[model samples]
Target: SQQGEEDPQALSIQEGENATMNCSYKTSINNLQWYRQNSGRGLVHLILIRSNEREKHSGRLRVTLDTSKKSSSLLITASRAADTASYFCATPGTGGFKTIFGAGTRLFVKA
Candidate 1:
C-alpha cells in the first residue's frame, strides 16, 4: 500500500529562500520521516516526527505532523544552491525492515 505522497511535483527557489514541502499518507503511521537526495547521492535522513509529536526541528529544518489529518510538512530555511535536490517523505512499509517513499519533490535552488 502507498504511504506517502508529496505535493508540488517540483519546486524552484532562489538561494537563501525558504522551501516547503508537504506529504499526505493513506494510512496511519507510527512515525514519519523526511529525507533529501542530492542528485545521484543516496537519501540523507533529514528529520523525523512521531505520531505523538506535533512538531520538531533540527537546525534549519522543521517538521510538523497532524495525525488527525494524516499529513506532514517539511521546511528548509535559507536554502542554498546545494539544497537543490529531491526531497522525500517516508513511512515504514508492511515489512518491518522496509520503508516506503513518496515520489518526491525535486527542488532547484538558483545561485
Candidate 2:
C-alpha cells in the first residue's frame, strides 16, 4: 500500500545552494516520477525515470534511481526562491489509472 516515503520532511536552503532529497519505495514499479507543487497549486511534472534507468536530469533537477535498493534521489542545483515548494514522488499503480505519492519533502529556498 504505502509505496514511497521521502526523508527529512522539510529542508531550508539558501538561494544559490543545492537541495537534495531522497525517496524510498516499498514495491517494484514500472517507473517513478517527481513533481513539484507550488503552495496550494497543482503538481507540475519534473522528471520521470524508468526502472532500468540509472539517472535522469532536467535543467536544475537531477534524479537517480536504484531499483536494487528501491530508492531514488532528487537533486536541485543552484536552488532559487521560485524553487521553494513541495516535491513528491509518484508511481503509477498496477492498473495505471491511479498513482501513489509520497507525503513529500517541503523545500524552502530563502531569497
Give Cα distance to truth, residue 39, candidate 2, Å.
0.5
Compute the lDDT of residue 79 as modeled in candidate 2: 95
Question: What are the lDDT scores of the predictions, listed in order?
Answer: 0.93, 0.94
Candidate no. 2 TM-score: 0.96
Q: Which stretches of candidate 2 lie over 4 Å from their true place?
A: none
lDDT of 2 at 75: 99
Worst 10 residues of 1 by lDDT: 91-100
Tens-digit lDDT string for candidate 2 (6-111):
9879999999999999999988998999999999899999999999899999998999999999999999999999999999998877788989999999999999
Clashing residue pairs, backbone N/CA/C < 3 A, model 1: none
Q: Would you list the clashing residue pairs of candidate 2?
A: none
Leading candidate by lDDT: 2
Best by TM-score: 2
Lowest-sum lDDT 10-residue window in model 2: 89-98
